[model samples]
Target: MNKRLFLSVFFLCGLILSSNAQEALFGGQNITSPEVHEDGSVTFRLFAPEADVVQVTGDFLPSVKIETQMGPMDGPGKADLTKDDKGVWSFKSEPLPSELYGYSFIIDGFKTTDPNNPFLIRDVASVTNIFIVGNGQADLYRTQDVPHGTVTRRWYDSPGLGMDRRITIYTPPGYETSKDDYPVLYLLHGAGGDEEAWISLGRTAQILDNLIAEKKVKPMIVVMPNGNVIQDAAPGEGNKGYYKPQFMVPKTMDGTYEGAFEDIIKFVESNYQVKANKENRAIAGLSMGGYHSLHISRYYPNTFDYVGLFSAAIMAREDATGKVYSDFDQTLKTQMDNGYKLYWIAIGKTDFLYDANKEYRSKLDSMGMEYNYVESEGGHIWRNWRVYLTQFTPMLFQ
Candidate 1:
């Protein structure tokens, strides 16, 4: 054959082979897992052909009793998935409520997220696929067609802690354009959570956006500080580099965090256009964050006019060593005497800390300290915290 003809034939054969390779690699493999139907029923699918047994676990299913060091609590339920002839395993759940749910697939004793689902969130070390059933409380968590806010990850100097820590701040809509000073809500996260927890798992930005748009709550600045004193920020976001997150970290409830809370306050007041006075300032948190909020609010005594504790760890540990943990009764009494606009506490009935909260409330009652108490229906979970945020913010700075 001629040289020109041979080269042309060789190029054409290469093109044909490349086309076949592309077809074999990615042809006809479009999957839609966790399809939410109109009736709120969800169908989860996993294309695991080599799996002998597959099960789907999520909060949407019936819960099972789980025993932990704290107590017996309800845990996510699991259901077996049926394998089809095409080697795809799937399970259709009953009509779920209009809320957010997390799920993972258990294939032959191995747990994995839904590969086809793009939406997922990491809570500490464990990550799971997430989805929302719209038209209810979750709608507030969803980004709606309304004026949006700006979320920024900023660093601040914590003088007491001797390090520059990171915080997640959410400036409300029209913040950039308006010259008005906004109220600030110091929203905190639970243990094992850092600056990113409220923004990612709690959906703080979305909730604020929807609530402010509907005029349900005041347009305020949300400052979410890293509750973990051991780390400067969330995993991989700080100079600590990537490390496995744990549910309990050192110095979490030891009052050093509460003592250094002023650093965060100083940074926000100096940087953002916020109302720095006590009346416009609010502090709230969930779990360990709630514990920090309670201590910090009392320790400062006159800094925050509004305080909220959602599923908060109300007990002060005997081993907790710090000035923040010292003189709890005196500081709390001083705070009560200082006269705050709102002191709100919310907890789920099944939460391990429910009795603690109740005992704390009884203490407040004996001391004649007025606080708004809200009891919810679930255990120690994010759903109740989100609900508490929705209910608590509206009562602030009114």
Candidate 2:
């Protein structure tokens, strides 16, 4: 054989051998990192025998308070893993509540994700593996055998901000064929979040799908808009580099988001067939978005009949110079007189904003306004937000 042909054949054989060795070392395609049992228990496995120690961290376990841009945030604590004779680290968790939890593996002081689990979610600056413990409310977050809706990442011109903005929209399952005009829910996200936060980390689509299929919630259109007024879209979109999320800064910008709210309303009404009226319109948000919802509903009293604040960052509105707005009380009074269908507020007992929400409720009481209040057990986390959404959406358009 020619020398050149022999050399080429030798290289090809070496490549094949290398591929086979890698497959054998990593256990090939038969690896299952997280094995969920029928009784709600979970077994997590990682093939990291070389590591000195391994542990699992997730929302299902206790969390340690860590300071963030928004405020003190809760992060999962570590659960140690046991290594077997085959160099595989494994841990089985006790039966947990029915909910969606985000978890990660810590190997030798390095935080890492489960290579065997394909499901993951991006939260703020970190990406963590997610798993759902079903059989109750969590089943709502899971994809079921029902008709599913479509989630689209759409962009619209924002002349006020002088840029184009991206939004995540969810149209109900029958939006295409049905001639009926559906109601609209303008759902907002918290700090360190963008438009995709709800649909991605909050599981908005799955919850809506299950609720609509079960005939529990009205088939409506859900719109999630970016709350940041400084930048148009989320980080890494529209050729923009990753922007570190800033808190309590957008409100100081020249243009107020509330003033630009009309643009979103116009875009949605013109683009989608929606019942654009007070009775059919609703606005709800979590954290900073909750603050926006409160101010927006107050500024435009006749726009939304239903308003919800989930662990809202509620306090007196202040100007650039740190003075409270003069017309705050009157504006809220006027909004209450406008007669809303349902003004709802929800918060976890251990939420960092619990005191703020309590103060806001006291103000509501003094103003003689009626609203619905829901209190649950937990802190400021996605688990509570998802629960709040599941409960709040059903009370709309009723």
Candidate number with greatest lDDT: 1
- Give the per-residue lDDT of model 2 (tens digit) for 13-127: 9999999998876656456778878888899998876999999999888778888655786768779999999888889999988989889999999998888887898876688
Q: Per-residue lDDT of 119-178 in model 1, one digit per residue for the tens? A: 899998889999999978899999999999999999898988999888999999999999
* Decoy 1 TM-score against native: 0.94
Model 1 C-alpha RMSD to native: 2.6
TM-scores across all candidates? Answer: 0.94, 0.91
| Best candidate according to TM-score | 1
Any runs in candidate 2 off by more than 4 Å, and if so which? 1-30, 69-73, 242-255, 316-326
